[model samples]
Structures are given as C-alpha cells and as structure tokens.
Target: MARRGPKSHWWRTRLLAIAIVSVWAVVTLALPFFNSISNGTGPGGVGIYVFMAEGVLVLMLALVFWFARRQQAIDREFAMAEED
Candidate 1:
C-alpha cells in the first residue's frame, strides 16, 4: 500500500468534509421541494408543517450523527482519534 501521511490524512478529511456538507446542503435545500410534493396531512392527521418540521429535525439529527461517526473513522485511520 502507498505510504499514508499528513497529506493523505488531510486529503481524506477534506473529502469527508465535502461529502458531509454536500449531503447537508442537498437535504436542507431539497426539504422544501420534497415538502411541496408531500404537502398534506401526515399520520394521525398531523398538519403538513408539523410533519415536515419533525421529519427535517430527525433527518438533521441523523446527518449529524453520521458525520461524527464517519469523521471519527477517518481520524482513527490516521491514528488521530481522541482518547476516551
């Protein structure tokens, strides 16, 4: 395998950052578009606004969680993970 150093680590980190930001931006921007399509009551007859809020909140939370885990993995690969 090719040698991995700070340069490689930095490159991987940048890639991960880009990926996370892209996904975040897409989700944030697409929410309204998707909301327009699903504009109606949700389960239990909840209003579209409430449903979209809850869905977007959950999605944002999940995205954050995923980013943390993925970043950690990249850090570990470079022996840069924080000690617990």
Candidate 2:
C-alpha cells in the first residue's frame, strides 16, 4: 500500500495564511480611521505613526509568507528524497 503523508501541516499553513491576510486587511483598512478619530489627525497629521505601523505589519507579513514558502519547499524536497 502506498503511504499517505501527514496533512495537519497543510491545514496549519492555510490557517496561518488566512490569519495573516485578515490581519493585514484590518490594519490597512481600520488604523487610519481610528487614528484620525482618536487623534483628530488627518492622514498627514500624527498619521505618520499609523503609516509606520502599517509598514511594519507589511514587513512582518512578508517575512511570514516567505518563511512559510521556504518551509514548504524544504518539506517537498525531503518528501521527494524519502520517496526515492
């Protein structure tokens, strides 16, 4: 009988991707509005801080996705080697 690989990691990666996109959407859409309402600042007022925060979030999300893709590639290579 052929062996089936584990699938939990696949689901976990999918969940992580979904969570990352959701958070990115929230940060991109909500932060500026909240900042403006709370700080009475427009996109040019203390809004620089909001932009900085969004930039950090984008960097983090990019790192996370990159790491996940690298990990998947490594896993695929290992699996192929094991099948030989």
Candidate 3:
C-alpha cells in the first residue's frame, strides 16, 4: 500500500474547504431568486423574507459546525488532530 503524507493531507483539507465555501456561496446567492418565487408563502405560512432571515442564520451556523466536524475527521485521518 502506498503511504500518503502531508501533501495529500493538505490537498484534502483544501478541497474540503473549497467545497464548503462553494456550498455556502451558492445557497446565499440563490436566496433572492428563491424568495422571489416563494413570495410570502413559506413554512407555517411565514413570509419568505422572515424565513430567509432566520433560515440563513441557521444555515450558516450549521455549515460552521459541519466544517468543524469534517475538518476534525480529516485531521484524525492524517494523524494530526489536536489533543482535547
């Protein structure tokens, strides 16, 4: 079996970071278009604006946590995780 090293780890980390950022950017940029289509109808009859205001915040927080979790897993795979 071929042994991977720091270079491999670095690329994996970079790719994951890019993917996370891309997801965030796409969702944020598409928000306005979705809002326009949905108009004032959202979950529980809430307006798109209201749902977006709260939903975006939640989405951001979720993404942050997701990134942290995934990053930690990558670090562990590379045997570089910090002591906790």
Candidate 4:
C-alpha cells in the first residue's frame, strides 16, 4: 500500500486561494459593470470603508487559519519523521 502524502501541500493552498480570489474578483468586479449597464451610474452598493475593513478582516482570517494548519502539519511531520 502506498503511504499518503502530507495534506498541506502548496498546490492545495494555491488552489484554495485561486478559488477564493476568483469568486471575490468576479463578484467585486462584475457587479459594478452590470449595475452601471442596467442602471447608469448606480450607487455602487458599497461604502468603501466598510468594504475595505471587511475584506481585510476576511483576508487576515484566512491567513491566520492557513498558518495554524501549516504549523500543525509541520509538527506532525516532524514527530512522524522522528519516530522512523
């Protein structure tokens, strides 16, 4: 039987970031375009400061979670390698 590889690979993190970014990009970028086309200089539906604060909070949360998971994975790997 083949042993399983570590879960926290770079590709996994990158794919996650790409997915989050793609969705965020599509929503943030396209909404304005459609709104402008449909309503002509629509209210942008946003307060810039609130949007900026929320975006930063979400990004920092993701970063912190990722960091914690990575550290756990590293510790697990170190413990396993030492056992061998």
User: If scored against the real structure, what TM-score would every candidate get?
Assistant: 0.72, 0.46, 0.77, 0.41
Model 1: number of clashes? Answer: 0
Q: In model 4, how many backbone clashes occur? A: 0
Best-matching candidate per TM-score: 3
Alpha-carbon deviation at 47 in model 1, angstroms: 8.4
The CA lDDT at 83 in model 1 is 89
Q: Show model 1 residue runs off by greater than 4 Å.
A: 1-3, 34-51
Question: Per-residue CA lDDT of candidate 4, range 1-84, in tens?
Answer: 213454544445566567666756765676546555645333544554345447656865776687656645554554433232
Tell me the whole-model lDDT of each prediction, alpha carbons only.
Answer: 0.77, 0.61, 0.82, 0.55
* Model 4 misplaced stretches (Cα beyond 4 Å): 1-8, 40-84
Worst 10 residues of 4 by lDDT: 75-84
Q: List the residue pairs that clash in candidate 2.
A: none
Rank order by lDDT, top first? 3, 1, 2, 4
For 1-84, candidate 2 gives per-residue lDDT tens digits of 213445744655577677767766666667666665657455475556756567767766786888667656545643532332
Error of 3 at 53 (Å): 0.9
Error of 3 at 23 (Å): 1.1
